[model samples]
Target: MIPITMIPRSEVQKIEKPGWVLVFGRRKTGKTYMLRHMVRHENYFFVTRGGLILEHEEQLLYPVFEERIKNLLLKDITVVVDEFQRLPEKFLDLLHYHSPDSRAKLILVGSSFSVARKLMERRSPLLGIVRPVKVGLIRPVDLIRGLFKLGISPELLLRIAPYIRDPWIMRFVNPGKFRRSDVIEAIRFNVPALIGEVFSEEDRVLTDRYELIIRALSLGNSTPGEVAGYISGFIERGLRSQDVKSYLANLLRMGIASRTQLAGRKRYLYSIESPLIDLFYYLDTKLGYYEIDVPMEELENLASVKEGTYFERFVVDLIASLYGARVQRSLDPEIDGILVKKGRIVAAIEVKMGDIAREEIIKFLERAPKEGEKIVVAREGPSLEGVSLLTHRDILSMAMNFEQRF
Candidate 1:
C-alpha cells in the first residue's frame, strides 16, 4: 500500500473548537480521513448504510447511543459522527436538543450538501447551532507533494493530475503502472455512482435536465445562451434562456458546474466543475450513449480533446489557487484565463496545447490588464517580451515549491 500524506487543511483547526461542526462536501474529498486524523478512535462513530446497528468497536444504535451520550459526564470529549446524514431523523433531533447545553463537542460529517442543508435549515431542529465547513478537493500543491512522495515523477504527475483531481481517484493512479484504460474504467463506474447518488437523492425533480445542462457545458457550450440552445434541441418544448439560467443556478448550488464572468464583462460562462463529470460526458458522447463498446481511434481522439481541455483548465485553476485569484472569461479577443483579486485584475493567462508565438503573446498582452501580469502557459513556448512563460513541468515545480513552503 502506498502511504498517503495528509495535507494540512485550515478547517482541521476549526474542528478542534468547541461547537457543532457540520462538515459538508462531495464523496471522497477526505472528510472521513481528516476527522479520523483529528478525533480519537473512542470518540468517533461511523453511521453506515445498514442503519443504526452497532458493529465492531464502539458502534451503537441510536436509542442506546443517545442515552449513553446524554448521560455521560460533560468533559473535553469530542463526539464525531461520520455519515451523520444516514442516521435516523430522531438522532439528528437529539443532537439539536443537546447542542445548546451539551458539554461535548459534536462533529457531524456529511457527504451530501443537500442532506446537510435539510438538517440545518431554518425550521430544522439544528438551525443556528451548527457551523458549516465545506471540504473541497485537496489543493493542487498538496496533491502534487503527496504524489511525489509516493514516487510519482513530476512529468507523470502533470499528465494525470488533471483527471484525478479528487483524492479518492488518486489511489488508483500508480505512476508507472497507470494507463488510460484505468482512467476510463474509473470514470465509467465511479463518476455515475457518486454523482448519480447526489442528484437522484437530492435533486431528483430535475435530475434529467441537470444532466443535460452539464453535458452541454462539458461540450464547450460555455455561455448561458449556448447551453440553452443546445439543450432546447432535445426537449419537447423550447427552453427559455431564463429556464436554462435556473437550471444552471441549481448546478452551481450542487457544485456540479461553475460560473465565470470577465473582469468588466457581464456575460457568464458555465463549465462542469468535476473532472470526473467532464470525462464521463466526453466518453459517453464519443461511445454513443448507452453503447458499451468504443472504437480505439475514437477513444484516442476523445482522450486528446480531454487532455487539451483538462490541461488548460488545470493551468488556469493552478494559477488561481496559488495566488488566491478568481478566474474569469472574456469575449472579443477571447482571453483564456483572467485572474482577479480584490475586484482588480491581477493577471491574464492564455493556455495552449502547442508552442506560443511572439505575435500571439503580443495579441494576448494587448487585451490583458495593462498593469497586471501576463502569462502564457503552453506545452512548448519561446520566451517573449513582457510576458511570463510557463510549461507544464514548470507549473508542477511551482506547485511543489509552494507545498514545501507551506
Candidate 2:
C-alpha cells in the first residue's frame, strides 16, 4: 500500500452518528477517504462504474453482490458501499427492505447527482431511514486544527489553506518544506486530471459546454448574461442567458459551482466552488496553459500574480463556514464579502493578500456595515482605530474555541 497522511475531518462526527446513512459530495472531496478511515464497518464493497462489485477478495456481478449484501445485512453486520451510485436502481429497494427492521447498519457513499436525487428527494424509499451527510472540501477550522496538530504554524496554514483544504491537493505538499510554488505546481500538474474525475462523477453530457462555462467563470464572466455572451463567441448560433442558467444550475447542484446573492438584489454572482478549480481554469484562460507547455517557473509567477482574487474567495468561504454565515456578494469594491447570519447581514470582510495599507483599511472600515462587524483578515495589520483586525492566530484561536464548544 502507498503511504499517505490522512487529514482528520469534522464530517466524521456526523458520519459516526447512529443508524443507516448516505454520504455524498462532489468527486475528489474525499468521501471515500473519510469512510475508510473514520467510520467503522465489518464489510466494505466498492461498486465500479461498470456495475462490477469488489468485496474482500472477490469481484462479483450485480446479482452476486446483491446476494452478499442481503446475507450480511440479515446478520446485522455493518456494511459500507463506496461508489454506491454506480449500483443498479434496485439497490435502493434492497436497502429499504433490510434497513428498517434489521439492526444492520448501512453506509452508502457516492458523489453523483443520481445518488443524491434518489436518496434525498421526496420520494426516496430510504429517505426516512437514511440520514444524508454532505462532506465538502475540509472545513477550514478542521483544517486549521489538523495543520496545528502536524506542527505547522497558524501563519503558514493561512497560506496553505487556499491550496490544500481539498484533501486530494495535499498529496503534493510537503508540510515541513512548505512553499507557495509547491501548491501552484500541484494545481498545474493535477487540476486537468482532477476536473476529469469530477466530470466522471456526473452524467457527462454537453461536456464542451460545461468546460466553456467553467472557463468563462474563471475569466470573470459570473452572471448568466456574461457567461452566455462569453460562451457564444465559441459556438455556432449562440446561446441565451437562460441557456447558460440551466447549465449553471446543474453545476451548482453537482457542487462544482457556487453562487451568492448580490446583496440587496434578486440576482446572484456565480463562481466555481473550489478556488483551486477557479485558479486552474483562470490560468488556463489567461495563458492557454492547458493547451501548451508553460515552464513551471512561468506558471508559478502567473499564479502568484492572480493569487489575490482566488485568495479573497477562499477567505469568504472559510470565514462564512467559521461564523455560520451565508456569503453575500456586493458591487462594493471596498469589501470582499458580506456575511449574513440568520438572514441578517452581520459583517463586511476585507481579505488582504499582501501588505495592508493604513489608508486602505480605513477606507474599508468607513464603508463596511456600520452596525455589526468590520473584519480585516490579513497576515498582519495595524490595530487601526476600532476596526477588528484578524490574523491566522486569531483564526486559530477561534477554531480552538469552536472545537471545544462542539
Candidate 3:
C-alpha cells in the first residue's frame, strides 16, 4: 500500500481552539478522515448508519447521550462527534447550554448540507454557538502529490483526475492497473452505494424529480428555462421555468449544484458542484436504469467523449481556485472562463482538451482585457506573444509551487 499524508487543512488548526466547531461537506470529502487524524481515535465518536457510537463499543441512546456529552464536556476533553446531524435537536441544545461553562471543545462534523443548514437555522439551537467550516475537495497540489506517491504518471493522472475528483475515489484508483472494464465495474459497484448513502435521505423528500433535474443538468441544459423544457418532455405534467428555478435553488442549498453568472450578464448557468456526481449522472444517462450489462468498449467510448468536457471544466475551476477568481462566462467572443478578482477582470482563460493553435490564442487575446493576462490551458500548446500557454504538466507544477508557499 502506498503511504499518504493528511494534507493539513486550515480548518484543523481552528479545532485546537475552544468553542463549538461545525465542520460540514458532502460525503467522502475527507471530513472524518481529517478529524480522526487530528484528534485521538478514542476522542472521536463515529456515527454509523445504525446511529451514534459511544466509548468505542457501546451505542448510547438519544437523551442519555446528551448527559454523557455533558459529563465529557465537564471533564474538559476535546470531543468530536462525527455526523452530528444524526442526533436530535435536543442534543444540540444540550451541547449549546453546556458549551459556555465547560472547558471542553465541541467539534461537530456532518456530510449533508441540508441537515447542517437546518441545524444552523435562525431558530435552531446551534445557530449562534457554532463556527461553520466547510471541508471541500482536496487542493490540486495535494491531489497531484498523492497520485505521484501512488506511482501514477503525470500524463495518466491528468487524463483520469477529471473523472475522479474526489480523494475518496482517487485513493483507490491505480492508473497503471486501470482498464476499460474498471470503468463499468466502478459505476456498477461504487456509484449505487454512494448514491444510496448520500441521496437516501434526500429521496424521501425530493422523489424522482431531483434525479430528473440532475439528468437534465448533466445533459448540458444549464439555464432554468432549458432545464424545465427538457424535463417537460419526460414528465406527464407541465413544468414551468419557476419550478426548475426553485429546484435549482434547493440543489444549491444542498451543495449539490452551483450557479454561475457573467460579470455583466443577468442570466445564470447551473451545474453540479461535484465532478464525481456529474460523472455518475453522465454514466447513468449512457447506460440507463434497466441496462444490467454494458460492453466495456461501449462504456469506454462514451467515457472518452464525456471526459473531454470534464477535463476542461476541471482545469478552469482549478485555475479559478488558485487565483481566488470568480468564473464568468463571456458572451461576445465566447471565452470558456473569465477570471475576476476584486471586481476586475484579472485574466481571460480558454480551456481546450487538445493543443490550441496560434490564431485561436490571438483571437482569445483580442477579446481579453488589454491589461489583464490571457491564458490558454490545454494538453499541449505552443508559446504565443503576450499569451500564457499552460499544459497539464505546467498546471501541476504551478499548483505544486503554490502548495510549497502555503
Best by TM-score, which number?
Answer: 2
Task: Flag regions of model 1 displaced more than 4 Å.
Answer: 1-14, 37-42, 53-59, 71-73, 151-153, 203-207, 403-406
| Model number with the top lDDT | 2
For model 1, where is the 10-residue window of minimal lDDT?
Answer: 1-10
Report the Cα lDDT for residue 329, model 1: 71
Give the per-residue lDDT of model 3 (tens digit) for 94-166. Answer: 8768767887778888888777777778898778888888777665555665565556655677666665556
Ranking by lDDT: 2, 1, 3
**Candidate 1 per-residue lDDT over residues 230-297, each given as its tens digit:** 88888888677888898887777676787788558777888888776787887786576335877656
Better of 2 and 3 by lDDT: 2
In angstroms, give how far residue 313 of model 1 lies from its true place: 1.3
1 or 3: which has the higher lDDT? 1
Per residue, candidate 2 scores C-alpha lDDT tens digits across 24-139 of 88888888877777777889999887888998789999988888888888775778999987887888888887775667788888887666777777888787888888887777
Q: Which 10 residues in a row give candidate 3 its minimum summed lDDT?
A: 1-10
> TM-score of every model?
0.88, 0.91, 0.89
Question: Model 3 segments beyond 4 Å from truth?
Answer: 1-18, 38-42, 49-52, 62-64, 202-206, 369-371, 403-406
Model 2 earns a TM-score of 0.91
**Model 1 root mean square deviation, Cα atoms:** 2.9
